[model samples]
Structure formats: C-alpha cells, structure tokens
Target: AQSVAQPEDQVNVAEGNPLTVKCTYSVSGNPYLFWYVQYPNRGLQFLLKYITGDNLVKGSYGFEAEFNKSQTSFHLKKPSALVSDSALYFCAVRDSRRSNDYKLSFGAGTTVTVRA
Candidate 1:
C-alpha cells in the first residue's frame, strides 16, 4: 500500500523568511507525489506534483518542491514566507498498486503558522 508521512505536526515561520514543509512517502513502482494546501474550513488546493522529469519541480503560490528518489522525499519550499501562506498542508501519493488508482493516501498533515 502507498502511504505518506508528515513527521511535523506544525511548522512556525516568521514573515519574509523561507519556509519548508517536509513530506515522504512509500509506494510501489514509480511514485506520483502531490502537495496540497487547505485554508481554514476550505477545500484542499493543489500545490505541486512530481510525476517525472527533473528532480526539481515548481508549483503554485510561489512554492516549489524537490523530488529526491533515493531518499523518497518531496520537500516543499518557499523562498519567502507570507502570513497568507499559513495553512494546513498535506502530502499525498497516488495508489498505483490498486485497480482504483484515483485514491490518494495522505499524510497526517502539517499546520503552517506564519507570524509577522
């Protein structure tokens, strides 16, 4: 079974500073990694993904992630943190092993709090 792990329960950052939210996963075959952010009481918004190609991938809201195949990690990073960027972030992996590959196994989630 494909699974994702978000080791951090929360991440705090000062406004204008760089921020990173870590994510790791276990999957059979080539993995499809995805990052999504959710504001308070809102739906999850897609951030970025790593399907193939370059190890470095860029996404929405000035966010980018580095895909490390050897380490099985796809860490999300922002050059500068913003108060508006504060939200609940999730790391997900598609379950390619199953017939219904649409299912996504998500991590526990990490809350990002940005302060001015």
Candidate 2:
C-alpha cells in the first residue's frame, strides 16, 4: 500500500531561519509527491510536486522540496521562515499502481510555528 508518514506533529522555527518538514513515503511504483498548506478553515493550497526529472523542485511562497529516490523521501524546505508562514502542512502521494483513480493519500498533518 502507498502511504506517507510525517514524523513531526509540529515544527518550531525562528523567523528568518531555515525550516524543514520531514516526509517519507512507501509505494509500489513511481509516486507523484506533493506538498500542501492549509490555513485555518481554508482548503489546502498546493505548494509543489515531484513527478519526474529534477530532484529539487520549487513552488509557491518561496518553498522548495527535494525528492530523494534512494530514501523514498520528499522533504519541504524554506530558507527564511516568516510568522505568516505558520500553518498546517500535509504531504501527499498519488500511487501509480492505481491507474483508474487519482486519490491523494495525505499525512495526518503537521503544524509549523514561526516565532518572532
């Protein structure tokens, strides 16, 4: 079964410092990885995705992620964190084994707190 695991329930980082949210996945074939951010009651907003090619992919809000095929991991990163960047994050994966459907399996969710 394809699944994603976010080991951290929350991440605390100081403003202007780098931040990272860990994510690992298990799948049968090449997985379509994505990172999404949710604020309050709003729906999740796409951050970035790793389909093919480049290992390092950049996305909205100056966020980036590195796809490590060897480790089966896709970790989100930001150079300088901001208080506004504080929100709930979810890591998702679309399993290739299931061709008929495009259901995204998401992590439980992780909250990022940026301290001023």
Candidate 3:
C-alpha cells in the first residue's frame, strides 16, 4: 500500500533558525511526493512536490525538500523559521501508476512551533 509516515508529532524551533520535518513513504511504483502546510481553520497549501525531475525541489515561503529515492524519504526544509510558519505540516504521496481514483495518502501531520 502507498502511504506516508511522519515520525514526529511536533517540531519546535526558534525563529530565524533552520527547520526540518521528516517524512518517509511506501509505494508500489514511482511516487509523486508533496508537502502541504495548514494554518488554523484553513485548508492545506501546497508547498512543494517531487514529480519526475531533480531531487531537490523548492516551494513557497522559501521552503525546499530533497527527494531521496534510496531512502524512500522526502524531508521538508527551511533556512529560517518564522513565527508565522507555525502550523501543521503534512507529507503526502500518490502513485503515478495508479488510476485517478487513487487518492493521496497523507501523514498524521506534524505541528511546527516557531518560537520567537
């Protein structure tokens, strides 16, 4: 089965410091990985994705992720954390070979707290 796992329940970091949220996946075929962030009372916003190209992919808010095929991991990274960045993060995956009925499997979610 295709799924994503986020080992951490929460991540705490001081403002202006680098932050990372780890994620790993299991899929039958090639995977389309994605990172999403959600604030209070709002839907998730797309951060980045690893489709078919380079390993390192950049996304909104100066965030980036590195796709490690060997490790089956895609970890989200940011050079500097902001208080506003405090939110819920989710890692998701979709099997490219699957049909449209295949929905994205998401992690339970990690809460990022950027302390000022």
Encode model 2's per-residue lDDT on 1-116: one tens digit a residue.
88999999999999999999999999999999999999989999999999999999999999999999999999999999999999999999998778899999999989999999
| Model 1 residue-pair collision total | 0
- TM-score list, all predictions: 0.95, 0.98, 0.97
Task: Order the numbered candidates by lDDT, best leading.
Answer: 3, 2, 1
Clashing pairs in 3: none
lDDT (Cα) of model 3: 0.97
Model 2: lowest-lDDT 10 consecutive positions: 94-103
- Tens digit of lDDT per residue, candidate 1, span 1-116? 78999999999999999999999999987788999999999999999998889999999999999999899999999999999999999999985556654888999999999999
Runs with alpha carbons beyond 4 Å of true place in candidate 2: none
Candidate 1 vs candidate 2: the lDDT winner is 2
* Colliding pairs, model 2: none
lDDT of each: 0.93, 0.96, 0.97
